[model samples]
Target: MAETEPNPLLRYLVSDPDAFAHNLAKAFEQAGKAAAAYLKPRETGDTDFGSTDEITRITKTLAHVGEWWLADPARTIEAQKRLVGGWMDLMSSTLKRLSGEPFEPTIRPDPKDKRFQDSEWNDNAFFDFVKQFYLLTSRWAGDMVEEAGDLDSHTRAKADFYVRQILAALSPSNFLMTNPELLRETLTSSGENLVRGMKMFAEDIAAGGGDLKIRQSDYSKFRIGENLAMTPGKVIWQNDVCQIIQYAPTTETVRRRPLLIVPPWINKFYILDLNPEKSFIRWAVSQGLTVFVISWVNPDQRQAEKSFEHYMKEGILTAVEVVEKSTGERGVDTIGYCVGGTLLGVTLAWCAATGDDRIKSATLFTTQVDFTHAGELKVFVDEEQISSLENQMSLRGFLEGRSMSTAFNLLRSNDLIWPYFINNYLKGKEPFPFDLLYWNSDSTRMPAANHSYYLRNCYLENNLTRGRLELGGVKLDLGKVTVPIYNLAAREDHIAPALSVFEGSRYFGGPVQYVLAGSGHIAGVINPVGKPKYQYWTGGPPQGSFTDWLAAASETPGSWWPHWHAWLTDLAPEMVPARQPGGGVLEPIEDAPGSYVRAKA
Candidate 1:
């Protein structure tokens, strides 16, 4: 018999004992630093790393599922048998493959699931078995939650979300020995990858001030006013809550009515003006519209007492006044994105109630006034969870920006969290500079009062569309706002589900042209006309269920910006000479993208 070749992994491990030992020691040292950083005392306002509230909540949710399943002996037996049967079939397939026979996998991951994308996961029998095993167990766990008939809708949703999170955390792809690519890298590099990765891990912990501030992009490469929010404009006015940015018109002539944009304070407004190429602000200005955006302040303890009413009064209401003053336009066309859109709706209602008709036409992007169909975000808005969050906020005077950032990341863990985790901590690579990811990492804090009111009134009670919401001693009635409305909902928005937005269109007492854009919340709204990568759908009035409306809607391939522009022009057809930023009554306070946006959380 021919002598068997030595295993490359073992050969490499022992080939240079001294070098390998040195690298191993260095890796251990870096890992110790990382451990030390993680165990260090947290700063003031920092969240407790070992907080048991969430763990207890998850445990109770899982227990509810277990109780339902175990209540009946038949159900328990059926669950066990199904799981065992899957494992048995998987084992049989592995055995056949080992015996030099071709065999099909017992189960496969969802095609969209990128976690098992490595070719070796299928070609190698061991990894193949591991992938199938995890898929089978995860699918079984999901089925168990779905089949639990007694769990309430909220509990069931919580259980499903938590279980998926737990499964994602335990994926074999996350570990070195289990992940084929990681194992290959370890052997080929003699564990040098781990040394570099551990060093980065420790540095990141320190950067986060005892929290894991995973770097999504090379943040150093991007700056707010220079590379990121470089739109030519002037900060004409500002109050405590926000600064209003009036963009200089690119066109020789502009619309009679200026446009005021209300972006969500959850993030910076530069998402609209990421760069000249992708900027909605630039595009709108070039389309002969005077554009003004409210750049919300990155609030701290000083703004902690600011409430939802304060945001409406000092933020949107003040911006409207400034835009009218600057452009000398009595009425303005207003656009709102996400939570900002929700606030816009409330403002419209309040304006109507107070007989203030400054807003002529209203456009909402991926905004949810009706939270009945609000997606997974509702999972984090229960009374218990909100109370816990409030307690944390009370101690800090504001919710830590990372806390919200982590929740948003968890919503799409595989895409957002895990990819970076693997690349940064496993492959030991720095992420490429991406403007969107950089903007994503630039988070903003939520003032305690403002955040609490938003949670309880919007997500928790669904009061905005129900005519139950009150602000500034005025009962807000969406039905009273009779402005021509353009409601745009993204087809795949997790933050504000299309169905939720669709349901909201009916609450407004006005003609609503409901359009559904392809892609998610960010991509759908930020789609520039020049690129036209996605499509938008249009139909008659938003009537009946979102599904029926979608079926009858006509699909147009390209950006929704032009379509929106056409609608906007039709509403206010008169043209006037272009208005320069701060060219009117309101003098320039500062440059565009404002100092408020520059103040980091």
Candidate 2:
């Protein structure tokens, strides 16, 4: 056989003199077609710019830009003045430092910011200079961004925020060459760290699309039933969507009304049962409350067709039935976290509408039923993003856990994303096996139908609060729910803002004890009474706004768990002798942290 050349396109390009000219003509022809297609609708007086919010935002941005253009002379003068003052201050500080005089940075790092814990910044003058200069540059850029009146709009502000984040992430200070400590380590290790970092990068690229944040060995340090979710309990009931874990009683007698906890399906239920020390389940059991938690299954294409109604029926309603049957009681106190709380609210509304009295009282943890002021998370749950996500899920039938995690991480990129990037890639070191980080890295997939319905009905359309959202054939109305409510909002929660969480109180007709916790979402909820790290505030229900409520609220110096437990105990029935796990229609299927939670997506 005769030898034949490969890559016909390459041969055609090189062999034919006219090929280049022909390709250029073809490219221009395609460009023209695309342009005509895009402009044809506009030419015919037809156009859909975007949603009302998007159009308003774009209009405001343009107006602000025009205003800035008109005020350019004054703004330019002000900016120059500020820049010169900043540089002069820097020069003075440098001279004082050279003379061995005491000097401090004007803008010190926030105590919460853990990015600069290394001692080198203080020990070395050169490193101090670089750090100070970087701060000055960042401040100048931030001032410029603020001065740009376009950022007045929330959408534009968020866009500018992320752009700054990308720029900060690409800063030289994060790399080995600019960082003094990394440079020293490279010198001492003879570039071994660099080799190891390269290897780690390659592995991450191959395995996780460069999203690896934990050491493979660290994952082995924890397991579903062994180290994590080790609270003494049994899987009393289970169905296709979720497993109900009934914790073994720790007291001689327990409260008459059993407690049912509905945790977010986005995370494993083990967050409530991480270990004996921090496990909310263990603590609740100790408090003489019969605790039952719903552990959702990590779904695959097999369950992608499952709707939010499916979750309400199979996840919460089924668990309520089993709990009531086992305890021989008609009513149970319900507690929900994040989306779990949102689901719990919907269930309560449904129960009230149908004259079902299974839920006696309700407690919501960092939950938002009203999406009006939903904080930073609202940036991701728009029409364009949801449509794109739907397309991806249509192929796989579920949203991949890792991909979803990336969006959540970006909400607090400096705290969560960059630190991991530096530790795993720049430092070439193994990540310390922190239990919370492990759980965060272990994510669960969202079923295509359920997730799409949730984003559209609850988030996009804001129907749940508007009395338009229906589930399991019941028209949910939060106003119909008359049970006493205990609502907790975390002050620093980026996912569900405290104001958004508090807004749900307006929909309920009953007495509500709204408490503001001190920390972020997960940390605020997981705060144990014994170790009480964050302070909480007790307040009357929503007054005028979150700010007004905060002004009137009284600060309490410890965890909100004690207050909640007390309120729960006061409402619950008289103490009765403890009962064994699994009875009635429900039988013990497995240990507490069942196979469902352990199943990988």
Candidate 3:
């Protein structure tokens, strides 16, 4: 009989016995390191790995979901039937494929789901079945949460968010055995991949202080003021809370009114000055606008007592004062991004109440004044969670940056979390160098009093929109902010939903031009004029519902920067000889992208 060739599929079962043994031994050593890293924090009295409060909250919320399903037998039966029916169809399809008969998949992942992009997921019967089964179950679970009519909106939102996370974690693509690509890598490398992966896993845990800070990008590949925040500028003012950097003039003539940017303390301000190509700050400067950005300090125990009121006073108001002193302009144009935008709104209201009109025009970027439709982030902001977080913060005097970073990552776990997990730990590969992810990983700590006040007043009570919020002993009324306002919202923003932003526009007392941009929170705002990857929409006013406003809006191609500049010019069109940093009044403290932004969390 002729010799039979071995099956290609079975090749993974065979390996060089000595090489396999060697890799296995090395992998064990790495595993020991990982174990030690995990326990190091516990040895230091930081044993709250799986938070009891979070566990209890999740259990109670899931129980509420269970109660709703159990309350009606018909609903329960319907859900089981839906899942079972999906499985039966998937099984049928698999059987047909095995018999060499043409058959369609019982279900398909969303087009945007990158996890199932591997061809083997569709070509291989086993993986196809695994993918289909997982999708079926996940869909059934989501349906149950959505149909739980008795549950309150918050509970429903929490359940939905949690279910999605669970499903994302449980995806077949996350497992080496179930993921064809990982299995192939493991087989071809004779398990050497696992050894390398385990070593990296240990190193990452140690780097995170036993908290497992997954490296989203090669941190060593980038550095602030060198390649990342490389925009030319000088730190002209400094306070305990922040360092205000005034960028050097890019043009011979610049806008008469200086531009002060109030970025959120949740992250560093360098996001706006990421690079020459993508930097919104650099682009704004090139557009002949004198730009000053607040680089918020990474708060520690010493700064724990700083409140939201302190940020308003020492951060925004102080930056405004310094800008006025430096530029010799009493009135200036201001732009705020994310939570900073929220603070700007409050400042505008406070200014309105106090009869201060230094903020000539206000531009808000993906900022939320109303929490009613605030997206998935609200899941982490309920009374129970906030109280638990406050308790934890009280012990440390500040909330760890990783906690917030983790929460934000969880909001898009499929895209952000699981991909890195599979790549770094299963494939033994380093994440590609990405400036945005680098900035994202570089997070900032939140002051205890400041974070607590924000959660309670904004997310918990929805105080700002209600005109019930007070700061500096003055009540803020959004309706009284009569400054000509330009409100920009990202259509797909998870942090600040377009609907929520639109609702906020109605509260402003001035003429508001509500613009809807493409993409999510970060990419939406940092869109550069040189490279136009997304489009934006412009409507008369943010009237009626967001859906209606979008329907009647005019679509414009490319970045929203030029449109914003045009609006700024319309507000204050005068151009003057460009002023250097410090304006010969406030002495330059240091080069731009100063020490404050470089401080690690």
Clash counts per candidate, in order, are 0, 0, 0
Runs of candidate 1 exceeding 4 Å displacement: 1-17, 43-47
- For candidate 3, lDDT tens digit of each residue in 1-601? 9989776577456367678788879988998999999999888877567577777888899899988888899978877799899899989989999999999988999998899998888877888899999999998999889988889988999999888988898999999899998888887788898898999899999988888999999888998999999999999989899999999998999989999999999998888888889999988898899999998999999999999989999999999999999999999899999999989999999999999989999999999988888878898887778888898999989999998999999998988899999999888888999999999999889999999999999989999888799897899998988889899999889999989999989999899999999999998898899998999999898889888889999999999999999999998889999999999998998998899999998
Pick out the ten consecutive residues of candidate 3 with the lowest summed lDDT.
Answer: 6-15
Q: Write model 2 residue lDDT over 170-286, tens digit each, in one string.
A: 654588766776766555555555555655655564345323433433566888799999887789887779989888888999999999999999888888888888888899999
Alpha carbon lDDT at 389, candidate 1 = 93
* CA lDDT of each prediction against the hidden true structure: 0.90, 0.78, 0.90
Local accuracy of candidate 1 as per-residue lDDT tens digits, 1-601: 9999765345224345576678889999998998778777554435476468889999998999999889999999999999999899999999999999988889888899988888889877788889999999999999999999988899999999999899999999999888988877776777788888889999998878787899999988998999989989999998889999998888888989999999999999999999989999989999999999999999999999999889989998888888878877789899999999999998999999999998999999999888999988888989999999999899879998888898999999999988889889888889999999999989999999999999999999989788899887889999988999999999999999999899999999989999999999999998898888899999899999878999999999999999999999999789999888876677898898889998877
By descending lDDT, how would the candidates be arranged? 3, 1, 2
- Per-prediction TM-score, please? 0.97, 0.82, 0.97
In model 2, residue pairs whose N, Cα or C atoms come closer than 3 Å (at least 3 residues apart or on different chains), thus clashing, are none
Report the Cα lDDT for residue 147, model 1.
Answer: 91
Q: Using lDDT, give the best candidate's number.
A: 3
The residue ranges of model 2 lying beyond 4 angstroms of the native Cα positions read 1-112, 117-129, 150-152, 209-217
Residue 218: error of model 1 in Å? 1.2
